[model samples]
Target: MVKARSVVQRIHLLQLALQITFRRTPLGVGMQNECWGAVAAELARLRGETVVAYYGISLREFRELIKGNKLTPAVMRNRVMGFRTLRFAVEV
Candidate 1:
């Protein structure tokens, strides 16, 4: 339960960070606005349902990366959902 809460907190932090950093840019606008959609897709994938796309990743790959501690800030930067979670953060 504690671990689950931490994961939830991390997601929230990432979400807020994204909103603060990127909400105004075109890319950030699209990603931040659709962040919830990414979460929903992940849920569907968890249920073993077929998904066209989940957070910029295929269901299988998403499942694999999430295992153990594979999901990290660096890994998130490389993953679509991470960006989607914190989508629109960090300007180039």
Candidate 2:
């Protein structure tokens, strides 16, 4: 019984972590906005494109992408790192 309770607790914690890491919230809104803004600005400068496209994924889609069995951790890390690099490059 004790072991089962402990397992349940761990599962709950994992779920919470997944939510925080994958979900878009006010907590990370500023960083997200700044990153996308920098990307848009740089793209505009390079291609003279006045309108930038931001693809908004529905909650279900986001969860599917982030939590899908086929998506590896490395892929997710690369995506996040790439975004950060783009943001930094544009700022410089």
Candidate 3:
């Protein structure tokens, strides 16, 4: 059961990581795209993957990378919900 618990914990951490990255990073705001590499690295760490392999996932491959991580539908939905809220809030 420890394994299952860790997975849940990782997902929760990933949520917070994504939220904080999106909330803090100046992504797509007329800034250079270099920061996306940092965002992808942070997420890949939580997803237990190589940062280089997903270095540009934040650019436009987010869903693909998330699918490759094998997260559940609920986690996927939660991610989408959080992303939408954050994106809209930034635009306003």
Candidate 4:
């Protein structure tokens, strides 16, 4: 249980970090190809895993969503909440 909770915490931290980083970085929030690429690379490096596999979202889809101006703060908040819920479940 402890190990599971640790893993959950790690994942939650990773998601929060990514969310903060992306929001604060002009390149990341702007949806520039280079920015998304950099974000994906950074995530891979930080998590030591492929970004698509870890996030369940492809870079192309992310770029398209950004290009379409479909990204919203509500969606991001929901994702954070979802991860928090996962972390809480593991703790219990």
- TM-score to true structure, per model: 0.22, 0.24, 0.26, 0.36
Candidate 4 collision pairs: none
lDDT against the true structure, per candidate, is 0.37, 0.33, 0.41, 0.45
* lDDT tens digits by residue: candidate 3, 1-92: 11122333345435544764455423321113323334545666777866434332233444544443333243244345356424423331
**Candidate 1: clashing pairs of residues:** none
For residues 1-92, write the lDDT of model 2, one tens digit per residue: 11122333333323333433453421212224423223333444465533212222233432343333223344354345344323322331
Tens digit per residue, CA lDDT, model 1, 43-89: 54575643333233344543543331133333233344445445322
Q: List all candidate RMSDs to the true structure.
A: 14.1, 18.4, 11.6, 7.7
User: On a 0 to 1 TM-score scale, where does candidate 4 land against the true structure?
Assistant: 0.36
> For every model in order, what is the number of clashing pairs?
0, 0, 0, 0
Best by TM-score: 4
- Superposed model 1: Cα runs more than 4 Å off: 1-54, 68-92
Model 2: pairs clashing at backbone N, Cα or C within 3 Å: none
Winner on TM-score (1 vs 2): 2
Ranking by TM-score: 4, 3, 2, 1
Per-residue error (Å), model 4, residue 51: 1.6
Best by lDDT: 4
TM-score winner, 1 or 3: 3
